[model samples]
Target: MLPDALRSRLALARRSLLPCRGCLGPVGEGAEAGLCGRCWGGLLPLPEGRCPRCALVHAEADCPEATAWDCGDALWDYHGGRPPLGALLLPGIKQGEAGWRKALLGRVLRGPLPDWAAEVDCVTAAPSAWPHRLLRGFDLSAEAARLVAGRLDRPFTPLLAKGWLRGRQASRTESQRRRLPKRAIGLRRGAAPRGLILLVDDVWTTGTTLLRCAQALRAGGADEVRVLTLFRAL
Candidate 1:
């Protein structure tokens, strides 16, 4: 028997007439695993034996982003499989769709924390431009970080600050995004998180932003950094 919370989500997914992704739906029988689109979309397990840090099915040569973290992981691989259902998850949160927050945190609880995650000392987030934060109901990264912190019983702090006038990174081309200025992100004044820090963000596109946040933490003297995003764009 499912818990009340899960029972309700499953019921709602059944009510949504949208076609399911693969095995998740097409009406009829009730059981766990594949109920409907939202249920499946809301919880995509990380790729088997792959890694989120590089969004790779297998890291061949050393990934360039490895330099910035002790360990990094995300809940879902944005491009891990066909049709790219993972890609839509981030926008649901950014657009302030109802229940997206709870749905995201639900992903975080899908499995036990990875062995590497046990060492995270503090939780912080990649800073978002203020206007985007306001438009999105709050800084998505910050809210995600707070949820992680609460679960881990660690302190959640705003240690990174984004440039005041910077425009949305999504509006820029891949080259433009990679060229994001180093100074575009920096440690907030007086913020000095020691030991391992977990950096949370909404999505990992080029990883330029997440790495930038990790870089800032290292510059401010954090011993190590780990990265977590709700979704990882492969």
Candidate 2:
């Protein structure tokens, strides 16, 4: 049998020969990177007109309701009723399509960041539920936070630790979701850091989870908390 290092190198070489996952076009010189320039450009110019505080689409110039986080941003608006192409790709990501997932996330990270992000002292993620992590085999939010931190040249910290809950928030009714205990998420014993923090998450549904995370960060002594999600469910 091939040595472990040789097998790993061969696997990477095979992946390098694959086409771009987004456009299914020839990866050419960028094969190792998983995306071609054209396909990467297609993901750009993310839909705008979202409330910077809640990341919700505001028909008016401002959000009517107040948001718990100091500010927020999202890559796409997920119309939950019909869903968008981005939403459709989310399931594939959670299913462990690493190439497509990395390409999509790379596009987002390479794009312009919010002005407030410049002031961010650290980056962290809203931890995934234990059951979900066990089933998905990866932490989507944590990966996103790491990518964002690397892109922004900020420190990445796992500030929040998730505790198992009775049911998945996605499977619960809006009212039931709202009733979820805030303590479902807690601050990591020594992970808290001072100053502005950018909390990353894969999606925003009712904002309850992010609120709980922000509360935990505050309780742990974060001066300011902001959220950055890949998509917003509207």
Candidate 3:
């Protein structure tokens, strides 16, 4: 991370070269976040009862009636056009801009999450398949977990690894995404943690990944597993 003095100097340089698109006013210092405070309200959280499993805004409560998807609700719907995500996800993860990591951590800290998250024993990120990490150059989920743990003042454990032979999640369908194989996650070599666990991720589309993570944590002796994600795809 850049020191505070250097970051302030960089923000000053950015203000000179960039202005707020909303007001066309010179974005004073610390406005690289792009939008001024007035324009930030549009990103406020929506109410629940969308998808009980993922907290997505569904047209009706009983979504996809035939399929019985069971899991704790998510915070937002990421599949929908959540414009702010472009400012956060693509650049930070795919492009390796570490600055967005802190920005995203700030958002999650301010966003809706279970009260239990504050009391968990430790935090961990959903394991990504080896191929995706190799191709993407960075593991966005793991990075987000570290940020959340820092903000929440909780331990961040690197206790999970991806299943053997599974590939990138982007290529899989909703059905195929469920039912993670037994090889999907394994504990790191250490004494098993005995209390609650918080799993962090960048986005929650169907929650197939989080559910599998919770299952793995339970098998490894974690008493409880809670999930926190930056966005939920409605």
Q: What is the lDDT of residue 156 in candidate 3?
A: 87
Candidate that scores best on TM-score: 1
Write one digit per residue (lDDT tens) for candidate 1, span 59-167: 5656555448756777776754444555554666577755645655665755456566666888898898877777767776787788788888889989999997877
Tens-digit lDDT track for model 3 on 1-234? 999999999987866767654445565544546544433333445364454445655676566522222334444444323235434444444655555555555665666666656787898888877777887677877877887788789888877777657765767887777755756667666737567888777776666777677777788898877777766655
Residue 129 lDDT in candidate 2: 75
Q: What's the distance in Å from true for residue 201, model 2?
A: 0.4
TM-score of each candidate structure, all chains considered together: 0.79, 0.75, 0.67
> Which prediction has the highest lDDT against the true structure?
2
CA lDDT, every model vs. true structure: 0.72, 0.76, 0.64
Model 1 regions more than 4 Å off = 1-42, 51-55, 58-61, 64-66, 80-83
RMSD of 2: 5.2
Q: For candidate 2, what is the lDDT?
A: 0.76
Of 1 and 2, the candidate ranking higher by TM-score? 1
Name model 2 segments beyond 4 Å from true: 1-47, 59-62, 79-83
Rank list by lDDT: 2, 1, 3
